[model samples]
Target: MPGFYYPIYFFQLDAIKHGVSVTFSFYSLVILNASNFVGRVTSGYIAVFVGVINLTIVATISCSVLNFGMIGLNSLVSVVVLGVFYGYLSGVYAALVAPLITTLTPDLSELGARMGITAFFVGGIGVLIGAPISGALLTSKYIWWIPAVFSGTISLTGGMVYIIMRSMFIRHQFKSQA
Candidate 1:
């Protein structure tokens, strides 16, 4: 979320920097958000088949890849495409996050407390600091790609963590069965 959030918060400025009309810049966000809505709605069914962890890992990694694609785009069409793609992938992560948490919890009794802690860390601290860091990277020159790379690296790191957690979960499962 830090990855997606920072880029989204600065998207308008980036678009305007590229000479895209202000109105269209705003519309780019709308397009992204609307696509996000669609992705959230569809993700449930997709997760049913793909499994929450697998789908989340795929979406997070895909988002990282797409953020790298944001580096050199100079057209509104390209921006719009990036918004739609990134939005959908990020939305998938959003939708599945709670379920992912559920899987991580060993006891249902601890779920609510764990969820709150997770939200505080991810949404509160991580997101709060990430945008400013990205903004700081922008400087007066508005070097958009630098921030894009930063965001991509964050997402990639998150994807790697998820991969590690998944492996640990599998190992635990196998041990319990044995």
Candidate 2:
């Protein structure tokens, strides 16, 4: 999520730098937000059928994969398309976080405490470092793709971590049942 935030924070500037039309540059954000709105609403319905953790994993992977497309393209059409997909998947990811956390915890009584601690640590650290690292990449100008690649890789890594966590959770559940 932090990885994706880089673009949400800096995309307008990036668009201007890349010579994209001003109108399209603005539309890029609009398209992303609109799609995100749709995704958030739809995810609630999907979560009921698919389960929150499952949906979150799918959404995370989708965002991770699409991040590569966003990083590699500069055309307005590509940006618009990728932006919308990324926005939607990201929205799903955001919507599912709390539910996913709830699913992982052992005690419903501890849910609030667990969520608060997780939010404080994870959100705090991500907010502190994500943008500055991305900005540093941009300022270095070692390569244009560095920031995008960095963001994409981070998102991909996050998805992989979630996969591992899910597997461990399942294993624990089975062991407890036995």
Candidate 3:
């Protein structure tokens, strides 16, 4: 989630760096938010058929690709396009993470505690660490690609983690059956 949101947090800065005015940058966010709403609502239903983990992995990876695409973006139109796509993918991730957590927990009684712990790491620690690191990468020079790469790499790493978790779950199920 932190990885998913890093681009959103710094979007204005990215826009300014790429020669977009502050006023237009705001519209990009509005567009993003609108599309995000659609993605969140639709992904919930899609997850029922496609599976939460599978969709999440796809969304996360797609978001990483979009972030990487940010490296060379220089126009408002392109940025707006990127925002629309990123917003949707990030929204998918946001909607599915809770269900993914539920699947990981064997004891339903521990769900709340597990969610709290996960939230602490994702919401608390990740936010704390991610922003600063991305900011530092940008620094006074405002080299956009540096932070774009950072965010993309983080998102990609997150997707890989889900893939590993899914594989582990499948392995566990097979072992138990055997």
Which candidate number has the best lDDT? 1
- Model 3 has an lDDT value of 0.84
| Cα deviation of 11, candidate 2, in Å | 2.2
lDDT of 2 by residue, 1-178 (tens): 5675776777666766677888889988998888888888899899999988778889977876775665665777777887788788878887788888899989999999888878667866876788789888878563557777888788888888888998998899999999
Off by over 4 Å in 1: none
What is the TM-score (0 to 1) of candidate 2?
A: 0.91
Candidate 1: residue pairs that collide = none
lDDT of 3 by residue, 28-126 (tens): 788788878888999989999998889988998999898898887789888889889988888888888788889888889999988888966656787
Q: Please give the lDDT score at residue 136 for candidate 1.
A: 92
Candidate 2 residues lying further than 4 Å off, grouped into runs, are 140-142
Error of 2 at 137 (Å): 0.5
Task: For residues 1-178, write the lDDT of model 1, one tens digit per residue.
Answer: 6776865788778778888899899898998898889889999999999999999999999988987887866788888898898889888988988999998898999999989989656567878888889989888888888889999999899999999999999899899899
Ranking by lDDT: 1, 3, 2
Tell me which of candidates 1 and 3 scores higher on lDDT: 1
lDDT, residue 99, candidate 1: 94
